[model samples]
Target: MRLEGVFARYGRRDAWVLQNVDGEVRQGDTIVITGRNGAGKSTLLRVLAGLLPVGRGKVRDRPDIVGWVPERFPTAQPFAVLAYLQGIARVQGLSQSLAQKTIDAWGERFFLTPFFATPLEELSKGTARKVGLIQALLNPPQLLVMDEPWEGLDAQSQAELPAVVEELTKNGGSCVLTDHRGRAADLGDVRHWQVHQGVLKEEDAPAPQEDAEHHVIEIVVRTDEVGTTVEWLREAGYDVHGTRERR
Candidate 1:
């Protein structure tokens, strides 16, 4: 979809949240939005999902179905986890058989079957976020929009999210998302966009750096063992300083 000079604001009295935001969300593409707090990142995502109407311009070619994962999952729902997601799938126009099948597939993918019967309000933030994600995918959207979807997620889920997103875009789905935890990892070429003061601009990707590059560390040795330690250090071409013990 193409954004043509889009502008948005919360209400009549509120200042504009997005200004002349021109952009594109193409198939098989991943766009990452970055910005400071209150920079309209969330607003832009909502606009992409058609949840918010732009005051000025048109978002052309927005897909028929858009899946959204808000930054925080509403945890006060009365339904069990599976029931909540199932309701979303059914509402999205999925058949009863298809909804059950898809929900179960995603539940297993996120290792969420254990919590399928658990109450929505009872799950922790991490677990609830998983449900938020599964509900979005239940209908297989053409556009997947997420806002800080990794917040409160455990290490395993955090690590798996990139793969899940990759699979979506690989299958011709478009993705737009925001992250405050630096750039995304383990994904293919990403289009990085920064929203500042309600203006959005594309940014050049940073030069790749080796995360496992060699690093130096310091060590201390006992004064009496200095001779032996120094020999070992010299043999290993390492360095250490001897320190006297306090009485």
Candidate 2:
């Protein structure tokens, strides 16, 4: 999928959210978008997903197989959690049984099984976000676009997301995602781009350093054992700093 000279504006006479943005993502690859608040990262994802119309550019992609996980899920829905996702799957061309099975599998993985029969309005913010995420992955779309996919998620849920992304890429699928927590590092061999001042630029991250001298070390011995460890280190001629206990 690719966008050629894409430009987007939110409202009449408003400043352009995206200006002359060009981006490409081939199958089996992941693109990570990073920027400060209001940098148009989410807008770019929407454009690529074909959810928002572009102002003055061409977005060429397989729309039929694109799945989008918006930043916020619609909370006013009258459908149950599983039913809503199943509905999306059905629209994506899955059979009724297949859609139900897919929803069940993902619901189980995301710990949404208990909430399967619950209405979306009754779920918490974090759980709603999970539902949005699962809906995007249920049908294995060719292109997946996610915005803040890991936001408001618990630690276990956050850890499970990388596996889902890996499955998508391994199946020759592509994804464009925006995240604030730097979880994109878990995507492995992903291309990083940053939006700055309405311009999209390719950015290179520094390689991880292994030199011990350049690293900050934290020794977390228990409070009772800290004194012993510090004393032992000092006796071994190490530059150790110790604090006494308040009697």
Candidate 3:
């Protein structure tokens, strides 16, 4: 998909949230969008998802499928979480039983199985975000757009996001995501773009050092013997690194 001179405005004003934004994303690519607040990061993602109309220029795509997950998950529905995910699955053209099965599987992966019957309005913020993310990935779209997918997630859930991105890209899917935390390092070889003043620019930074050498050492000491261990090591004329004692 590509956007050429794209511009968008929320109201009748010449000030566009996105102005003259031009970019291209090929299949199996993961592009990370970064910017400060109100830099039109989310606006650009919505435009790419076709949720917002572009006021000027054009967005061209020949996608076989598309999926989107906003920064904020909608949790005002009266239906159960599983039922809501099932609805999304149906929209993706899955059979009823298939949809339920897929939802169940994702629930287990995201640790949301306990909340299957819970109402959408009753879940915590992180859990709701998980539901939104799973809905987008249940059927695997050709294009996936996510906004702040790591927000409000616990340590475990945060660790799982990179794996999900890996699976999508492995299947020839593409992704455009905006995040403030800049934690996409685990995605591996991602193309980084910065949105500034309603424009997107590619950042040219030096490549990471791949052949750097590193070392690791482990030691075990008896309880309350940490000071003695450090003193003995120092007396032996060995270079001692830092030390820590865990209760």
Maximum-lDDT candidate: 1
Pitting candidate 1 against candidate 3, the one with the higher lDDT is: 1
Least accurate 10 contiguous residues by lDDT in model 1:
234-243
What ranking emerges by lDDT with the best candidate at the front?
1, 3, 2
Backbone clashes for every candidate come to 0, 0, 0
lDDT per residue (tens digit) for residues 4-50 in model 1: 99999989778999999999888999998988999999999999999
Model 1 ranges with Cα > 4 A deviation: 207-247
| Reference-based lDDT, residue 117, model 2 | 88
- Candidate no. 1 TM-score: 0.82
Query: Candidate 3, which segments miss by more than 4 Å at Cα?
Result: 205-247
Q: Would you list the clashing residue pairs of candidate 2?
A: none
Per-model TM-score versus the true fold? 0.82, 0.81, 0.81
lDDT of 2 at 185: 81
- What is the Å distance of residue 4 in model 2 from its true position? 1.1
Model 3: lDDT to the true structure: 0.82
Candidates sorted by TM-score, best first: 1, 3, 2
Best by TM-score: 1
lDDT (Cα atoms) of all candidates against the true structure: 0.84, 0.80, 0.82
